[model samples]
Target: MSEAQDDDVQEFAASLTRMKERTDRSYGQLARRLNMNTSTLHRYCAGDAVPLDFAPVERFAALCGATPQERLELHRLWILAVAARQRSRTAAAEATGTAGTPPEPAGEPVQDPVSPEPAGEPALDPVSPEPPHRPWFRRRRFLVSAAVATALLATLGSLSALPDDDRRPGASDSVEAADPPRATRPGTPRPKSTKSPSPSPKTSSSPSAGASKKSSPKPGERTEEPSKGPGQQRPPAGVPLTWSADSHVWQAGCGHDYVIARSPRQVPPPPAPQDAETWAGTQNAVHGRQTLVEVSVQGRTSTAVVLEALRVRVVGRSAPGRGSSYAMDNGCGGALTPRYFDVDLDKDRPIARPADGNDSGVTIPAMRLPYRVSAEDPEVLLIDARTKGCDCSWYLELDWSSQGRTGTVRIDDHGRPFRTTGIDGLPRYSYDTSARKWVPYS
Candidate 1:
């Protein structure tokens, strides 16, 4: 066989294996469903040999529940495999200096033998067919490769141009698979995973956006006093504002428990805790704290709880360098934008710039803690940042302890939380004298 034929066959087999995995079925089950021998299915999956028929390839893809586009790609690969086989056969025939008659395709019925002409009528000689031109066939193969390259480039460009809001929960990723939440390195903030935005709670005219619903205190449990921090103030007196009826899941690293906080209005069943942590972490921030919130375990639901307050505090700053820089020519050829920076206030350290073209201003990691809020002291900052972007969004998280008690808070905002072009310490909400309104992150 020619080298090109070998490569195509291998690629086809690899794609088949990937499709089979997406079906979440065992190989034995697949073999039964496809009506093929176990060993034969194994060979196809193992890239030992390419199938000679396209019908079985299509059937296998259908049985594996491949999407229409996936099935189309599989069919394309099958065609390449067939072309590779033809080239290999043609090469072999040329090397042997003999015309190779095309073999009957697999799964076809054999024809009956023709009756001999009655008694010796003069037999006519059969006409020979012309051999295929080798050079022309080689050029056709080159053209096929060029077409494949163009298709790949188009696919990548479309993906790169997708808007941030187009990314939704349960939506297929670039690879069309649901990836587990990524774990962040200790001292580095956690990466944000945005789900479809549900309705947010009605923000009170008060400065704090989210309000925590009151939970009944445990029998004989001692409540701690509120701690005074820099620029801290007393919570307002009134009916504590209610949050929207929604549940939220925060993904931290391994050894850390999964948290699903629900508002007081809804009583959704809690999901089972994972047997193991989804990612690795140091568990540094939640240390020295006690578990105050009742989390959902495998088979039971917990009482609903709400967030008291979510705050943002500036902790550190950074200047964009080669590793942190973004495009100067973002379709606008005026003055170059300044270098970007990201700060993790909780860790009191600066983070590296994003490696993509999203022009993110800041990323606040999610935090889960063994903390509860006091009615009087509601100021607990989850995450804060100053960032740059025209059409982007970011997440903020803060976990804190006041007077030996602890609590958690989070925030989500469209666009950067801070102006990208402003001085480092300024929050995105700072007033802009030039624009006559709050500065835009863009």
Candidate 2:
């Protein structure tokens, strides 16, 4: 191999290794995110292999949050490596003085490492396809965020490909071990990080004020106490909607409200009628204006749509200088955290103000969950809204547009898909919080 080509390979490997370390993700973490074997990723960083396609490389770089300048440099290095590889193959063909039969493709079972190459020579190997086992809920949160970021990147044209089949091996790839990996380097095997399912709040048949502060019982173990009277315990405020043990989905009786969270946690009891004054005042604060459109979520831009339904339901507007956001109110009465909310454009009633004090105070059998009003697809608005309620999680309102008509369907705030058969015999359906009825789709 020419000295110049060798140098290019080494430089590219070094740059990749450096950026990977910056991401603070273990090789396994990255492999899971990239949907490939850890060894393959290790090879890429070790300069043992170069992907024939730029798709995975581009995704890896973006997942690591590569800057434009860095991306350009990486692209340049990739080109050089490709040239170097081509030159090596040509030289080998010339040396043999015969066009040798092509080698079998990658994804074969791992054989013993071939003889080590001379120092400074690239160690080439056929790329393999074997994805390590991924446990349930393992790296789930991170995967969600990564998926969102990848989607955003694809949307922005930064990514060239996003195959639904993540495990597909690159058609053409050649590996050359540029150098022995250093002990402190990223490619070396490391222990996978342990992740436990997120904890759920304590579940009880009744809602209590101190539920959030109480330690939750272990899953499958519940403590039963004497049922408290209505005054002693908070009456179920929101209407009972849907509950699925398998899906961990809980919808309000008022409908159009849902929250996604860890399984078996305490579902916040319905909001008390007396406490209605607290959130009821929100009706006076804003309604009917599309002022808060064009908001940001996890750094990606989105537009908040103010539906005509909301405008007709309430007389209000967004607070000046406030961002449009939504989230589940767990009744904790604390600052709201940012969570994803999917609002449907075709089914949900637009954000509107409640009626007078009685109407506002009137308990709606709703979860009062949060939802993002806008999404990348105009038909489906994915909102990144916030809330001040501590007990609340987040909710999603599904948006669909057809025949020039748009409506929003209410999904659980967690954005989980509803099951066909709920606890009762009735088929699961989305609630129209505005119309105070079930949303039936043809």
- TM-scores of all candidate predictions against the true structure: 0.26, 0.25
lDDT of 2 by residue, 1-442 (tens): 7888888788888888888855424565677899987668878888878888888888899988799999999999998987898898799788876685433335432232342333453323336422344222233345567779988977878445655344433332222222232133222332211111111212355466436443322222222223344445332211111111112111221111232221212222223332321232222112111111111111012333323221211112222222221122222331211122323222224342222111224432221223322332112112322222122122223232222223332333122222110011112233344654433321
* Candidate 2 lDDT: 0.38
| Model 2 vs. true fold: TM | 0.25
What is candidate 1's lDDT per residue for 1-442, written digit by digit as tens?
Answer: 7677798989999999898754424455577788886557767877876788878888998877678998889989988987887888888788875675444445432342232222433222225322334333333356677779999999999989997445334342122122245554333333332222111212335434224553322211112223335665532211121111111222221111211122212212112222111221222111010011111111001212233233333322344211111111112221211121224332343342222112135332333333333321121221223333111122333333333233333322211132122223322222233544433235
Tell me the lDDT of candidate 1: 0.38
Model 2: CA > 4 A from native: 100-442
